[model samples]
Target: MMKKVRVERDKQGFWTHPQLPEWDESTTFADSKKWFSEKGLDCALVIMDGDLGEQWGNGEIDSCLAWEPEINIQDAYLVGIWDTEDGVVAMFAFPQIILEDSDKAAEFKTDISGWVSSDGRFYGKDERLARYAGSTHRKCDCGNIIPKNSYCNPCAEKRTKEKFLAMPVVAWDGASYIYDENTDKYFSNPEELVEHYAVDDLDSSSAMLIVCKPNYARQIEDDFWCDDLPEDISFDECGGVEQETISLLNKLNEKLKTTVLSYSPGDQRLDQSLLF
Candidate 1:
């Protein structure tokens, strides 16, 4: 690992780079790339979300860095910054081209996995590296070992399907109930029974009279399946409402009302209230 590079901003919103003082907060990504190109480093930008690096000291914000593909250069460059016991620290790391010789550059590229340090040294593991590493095994956001990139296998597939085909399934992997495509069933992710229900065709905003008509609520409560739900009771059908779901909606509505109370009726009011 190398030492960390330092970055700081003055009171005037001017960001400073210890290694690359010529570049600052005002510097655009294109300008930075051009600067790196002038310095003979064929680099690309790698912007990682702060959450991914939070476990390592990086703030939960977006961090951008220039990734050099041809690392054969002599000078190591500033990578990014992270928080330390003292304060925010800038870091640096070597690219494959600079670290390895021509014969080993390819192998280095294959195994180029490392973390960022404020002292400008490469640490252990990094999510950004793992994403491009093309490794067979990956860890999901839920801490489960997955087979694909950032998310678990099923999650990745579900996300792809949802994005590509606009699937109506609401992914509830973080919730108590998780959908299982294997058996077309729902499973309890919780350790014990929590008195939850799976609602079907329950529209929250509509507030239709039929919802309170006869034994509709009772039928819904009665048909609530903890393990699995019927096919008709999906996001596409609506009308689903569990006890907690209803409570959440009520709370949300109350909060919305309170928020509306604080603001003027027209949309133009937001322009006055919110900061640009």
Candidate 2:
């Protein structure tokens, strides 16, 4: 009999250890490969445990998931070995010995496990192996793995949504913009935000907008709008704000038939909404 520490990949995609979070975290296939480089052990050959065993007879699997050759199931706790891109070489990390004509026997417990007499396999679930090796499943041209159908469910739905997005839409004129890292794009329209950076506010420091008209002289003498007091500005250019100087521009532009200026907010001479 051998010992086995069962691990399960959780719903959140984490392989947790029963007792040690840190230890379990290190067992990630990616991390396992990284450890070798960090410790300068990349050149070391892996001395895998367990060897090809004799066959086990019918009906004696005390260990969980013990490989049953009669059914082509694994015998024991086979540690799935992932390759450079995962699914490299599959190994049976099992070790319990079985007697009598065993093609391949997996132990629920340990000693070590054996590999087939060839290469290029990774220890993974049947579905996973089927997906990667095209053993029992096929890949969509979209690169989605599916048991059947021209497209995976997700790919089909994605295409449908893409068509929906392609439909013409009324353009919105909003000033804000967002940057998408995945696509390296800048797009407006708040409805399309996804995975945006956490920067809540963008500052355009002391920014102001001045509405201008077409065909105007570029350097025409215009009133300067400043948040702070300017030393050389004439009071007339300040919209003649003083009640005494208000007559300088005139109460109305008689030629244009529009109010030249209305200093009072309550002035109902013109429709404020229409002015906008």
The candidate maximizing TM-score is 1
Clash totals in order:
22, 22
The Cα error of candidate 1 at residue 144, in Å, is: 23
Model 1: residues with Cα > 4 Å off, grouped in runs? 1-7, 21-31, 34-276
Can you tell me which runs of candidate 2 are displaced by over 4 Å? 1-5, 8-78, 81-145, 149-154, 157-161, 173-276
> What are the per-residue Cα lDDT tens digits for candidate 2 across 137-236?
3557686544432347767667854643454432223433433322334444344432232243322221111111122222212243343436566545
Candidate 2 weakest lDDT stretch, 10 residues: 263-272
Work out the TM-score per prediction.
0.20, 0.19
lDDT of 1 at 110: 30
- The residue-by-residue lDDT of candidate 1 on 127-215, one tens digit each, is 34423342334346666643343345566666744543333322222333333232233334322111122243333222111001011
Q: Top model by lDDT, which number?
A: 1
* lDDT (0 to 1) per candidate: 0.36, 0.32
